[model samples]
Target: MSDVRQLLTSLQFADSAFPSGFYTMSHGLEGYRQARLVSADGVQQLLADLLLHSVGPGDATALAAAHRAAADGDIELVQEVDQRLFASKLNAEMRTASVRSGHQLIDLGAELIDQGLLAEYGERVRLRSTPGCQPVAAAVVYAANGVATRQAVASDLFAFSASFVGAALRLRLTDHRQAQAILLQTSPVMEQVTEAALERNLTDLGGFAPMADVMSAQHERAEARLFAS
Candidate 1:
């Protein structure tokens, strides 16, 4: 029964309608589209590359570490993980988007989930003690709700993928059916990426995607923009 409840909690948080502010983010897909570097057919591969290279190594790893810290009641360690993740984000837009979404998640989690750790973490974020990146905030919420570390990491990854595909749909790079197919094709990559994230340590907290970083940096200065990194 407890396991079932945990699964439900994960689902609730992972839902695209849960208002984690992901709808406003293209996760850099719009930047790639604007640069003409990505096509409709290339959407799945681009998403897979991001999961394997960037999100998996960076954000996912931090989530796993933070989850462990939060589960162990080591708020300081969780803060350390959060700070490290924030510092690793290369561009200002990316950093701002993360912290923005994270703030929303932490605040909502505090009100809807557990008021204990979520409230404390929210206070820390308010105090500027931590940057409150989305993954770390998610780790705290999932841990507080008794969700396992692996499930939490995977759930967030899926949410990211969904957001990415949804962005592609809005950008006209792909239609609804194709977007679902892309997500289906990306499942194996998600599993592999999730495992790799679980095995990573705090020191391996950053991703190395030079092209994506370049695109994001360009997007930051574009005269016309539709998404916030």
Candidate 2:
């Protein structure tokens, strides 16, 4: 029964249909497309790089930290993890995308999950005490819902892929079949990244995706865009 609950919670948080505002943000994929730097093959490469370099050491590591902290009833540490992750995001759109999605997730989770911790954290976010990045919000929800930390990180990373692929399909970068292939090929990379992310401490919560940051910054000033980031 506990296993079933965990699976359901993971699925709920990961589902694209969830009102986490995930569909509105492309997470820098739009910038790559506008720059003509992405083909179908490049889509796979970008996802792999993001999983390993950007998302793994940054958001996934923060999620693991927040999960452990929440488990130990340490909300202060969760805020610290969230702030560090926010500071590491070099692009404004990147930070906005994460904070927006995270705020929405916290709002929805607090209403649905009956978790006092989320409510308290939501207050902190309301007070601007924390940036309330997506990973931290995910960690809090997963911990409250009995999902394991590794699974929480994995789910967050997968949700990111789903959002990126959705953007690619809309941008006409890939067809449905090719998008499916991208997800299939990227699954192993996601697994490996998740493993590494789980072993990271809060001090290891930084990323080196210079190109992604540049692209994201460009996206912020684009004349037009299909996605927010």
Looking at model 2, how many pairs of residues clash? 0
TM-score of each: 0.98, 0.98
lDDT tens digits, residue span 1-229, model 1: 2878878988988898989999999999989999999998899999999999999999999999999999998999999999999999999999999999999999888878655767888999999988999999999999988899999999999999999999999999999999899999999999999899999989988999999999999999999888998
Cα RMSD to the true fold for all candidates: 0.9, 0.9
**CA lDDT, every prediction?**
0.93, 0.89
TM-score of model 1 (CA atoms): 0.98
Please write out the lDDT profile of model 2 over residues 1-229, one tens digit for every residue: 2878887889988998988888998888999999988887789999999889998999999999999998787999989999999999988888998999999989888888788787888999999999999999989988988888888889888898998899899988899999989999999999999999988878888989999888998899999988989
Misplaced by over 4 Å in model 1 are none
